[model samples]
Target: MNAIIVTGGDIDISLLENYIAENKEDIIISVDAAITKLEKINLIPHIMVGDFDTLSDDDRLKKYAELDVEIVKHDPVKDFSDSELAVDRAVKVGIKNIAVFGALGKRFDHAFANILILQKYKKLGVDITIYDKYNKIYVKSNHFILERGKLWGKYISFFSLEEKNFMEKLEGVKYPIENRIIDNIATPSLYISNEIKGDKLKATFSGDLLVVESRD
Candidate 1:
């Protein structure tokens, strides 16, 4: 099954609506305060996971309980973040594809940590993509083909997620590169802000790479 984990962060209502419209059959997991956002959209979460720090409304909690939503409450001092727990629940339930929403917000550290959660599930072959108002982020370790008009934004940036050196190549972009070695330990910003130029954008890279497709 596929899943959409909503975290407590800056959420784009339009993006959230689009995701819901597209992934209607997928399971929805609400992480803490994200439930409030879902409530506004008239979306009843399939599973609720968090410490209840942001879910302080007693009536809402009672309503959720009456609706039989699977609630997995955690401690305030737990090691893993609420977002991580939510994604882990999805993975455990045999979800192969996961799309995270409302992950970026005022809390920069939480936002960054939520973005890096992609790496945890990447090794398990779970295709995870984080969708915010201005960006779609995921980790890539092999060949990728991105069509020009289908991209969410005009700019695509690649960064190494490892400490080793590897080769990378980009084609069908404004700034194309041959077989360039990317040394993560030394120079990490070698591949940045490459715009799609033609019909398709092709990328082949060794080692772990984080791809960020962004807009203005």
Candidate 2:
């Protein structure tokens, strides 16, 4: 099944609407404080997972109660972030494809932590896409097919998620390269800002890579 986890972040409402429209079978999971956003949008989450710190008072929890949504409350001292907790719940419920919204925002550390959350999802054999107003981020360890018009953003780039050196191949991009070994010590900015040129683009890499499709 498909699922979506709405976290506490600055998200584009329009993009969120598109995500909801496209994934009709999505199980919505709202993190603390993000419940307000879902309420504003007139959408109730299927499950709510968080410490409820942003709920302000018990009255806020009442709204979720009225909706009969499943609530998984946690302690503020927990190790996993609220977003991670929600993702874990989704996985436990057998969600295969998950789109994460409100993950990119003002807090740089939180945003980066949310990006790293995808690693756990990858290990769990679940596909997750972290989306925002400008970019879509995911970890790719194998070959992937990219279509020019099917991308979320204009510029496609790859970054190393690990320190290991590996060979990579690129095709159908503005700058195509073959069997190039990426050095961990060298400048990785070389793989940045590459544009897709043909109808389809293919990427094959030996090690872990973070793929970001972004706009200007």
Candidate 3:
């Protein structure tokens, strides 16, 4: 089953609410302080995972406890972040597709780490996407097609995560690329701010590609 993870970070509540409404069958997971956000929307997560160090309302947690929400609490001094813990819990439950909310905000480190989690779990055969109001981020290592009308945002960008340069071909976008070498270190902005042209955008790349769909 698909899973939706709510973590402790800035989020667009209305967007999240709409997403949850549309995917009612998907599993919901709350991470620590993120419970407060879900509580505001009158949504109770199926599973809660975190250390609870940042949670402000202990009473709310107790209320979930009364309802028997499966809470997997971790030690405060743990190696993994709360977001990671929540993702791990979803993976343990055999969730192959995961969408993460509240993963981007003021804490750049946490946001970066959460983005890395997409790549980490992708190696384990799980597909994870980090989503916010304006951006959707994920990692892809193969050919993919993004339909125009259903795209997450107006602009799509790609960044190489490989150490060595790799060849890539992109089509059906404003700026199409044909067998171009993408350098991981140099010319990082070579593929930023590309807009899809017709019905769909197709990409075929050699190495790991960090894809970011964004809108201003």
Candidate 4:
């Protein structure tokens, strides 16, 4: 199954929310601040996962539709990022794939951490993608297929998130690399701006590879 996690990041209506508004049925799982974004869209979350610390102490929860909301509260003492927790819950509910929004942040630490969350999904054999106004990031472990219509960030970088870095590859991209190894360090900004000349952008990996399909 697939799910959508709405994180507390940027949700500029003119930029990214339209893409989300159209796909209403995609499970709307809100994490912390994303609850406000859901509120702005006049949509209540199907599920809310986060420590209530970010919210108010008042009974603000009753403002939504009949049942208020399905909230999964966590401890303020835990170290897990809200996004990871939400993704974990989705998996427990039989969701194998997830698309996250409002996760990439305006702050460097938050945005960087959000990108780093890709590692959690990688270990679970799940395909996860994060979207913002400027880019889209995700990963693939086994063989999968993608068509031309999808363009992520201004640049696209694929890396090996494996020990000894034994399984990283890319195809249908501007700079196609052979089966190689990449590290945890930030990748070089070279593989950006790749246009899919036609359909069929494919990649297969032995370990884990993160493909950041970005826009400039």
**Which of the numbered candidates is closest to the native, going by highest lDDT?**
3
- Per-residue lDDT of candidate 2, residues 35-113 (tens digit): 8888777898899899988776677778678879898899989998898899899998788889999998999988999
The sequence of per-residue lDDT tens digits that candidate 4 reaches over residues 59-95 is 5655543466678888878888887899889988878
Of candidate 4, the 10-residue stretch with the lowest lDDT total is 183-192
Task: Look at candidate 2 and tell me the lDDT of residue 183.
Answer: 53
Those runs of model 2 whose alpha carbons end farther than 4 Å from true positions after fitting are none
Q: State TM-scores per candidate.
A: 0.94, 0.95, 0.96, 0.82
User: What's the residue-level lDDT of 163 in candidate 2?
Assistant: 61
Collision count of model 3: 0
Q: How accurate is candidate 2 locally (lDDT)?
A: 0.85
Ranking by lDDT: 3, 1, 2, 4
| Global lDDT of model 4 | 0.70
Q: Is candidate 1 or candidate 2 better by lDDT?
A: 1
Candidate with better TM-score, 2 vs 4: 2
User: Candidate 1, residues 142-195: lDDT per residue as tens digits?
Assistant: 788999888889899887777653556788999897777766656667677889
- Model 1: how far residue 84 lies from native, Å: 0.3
As for candidate 1, its clashing pairs are none
Instruction: State the lDDT at 25 in candidate 1.
Output: 96
Mind giving the per-residue lDDT tens digits that candidate 3 earns over 5-106? 999889999999999999999999999989889978999999988999988667877889889898788899999999999999889879999999999999
Worst ten in a row by lDDT for model 1: 160-169
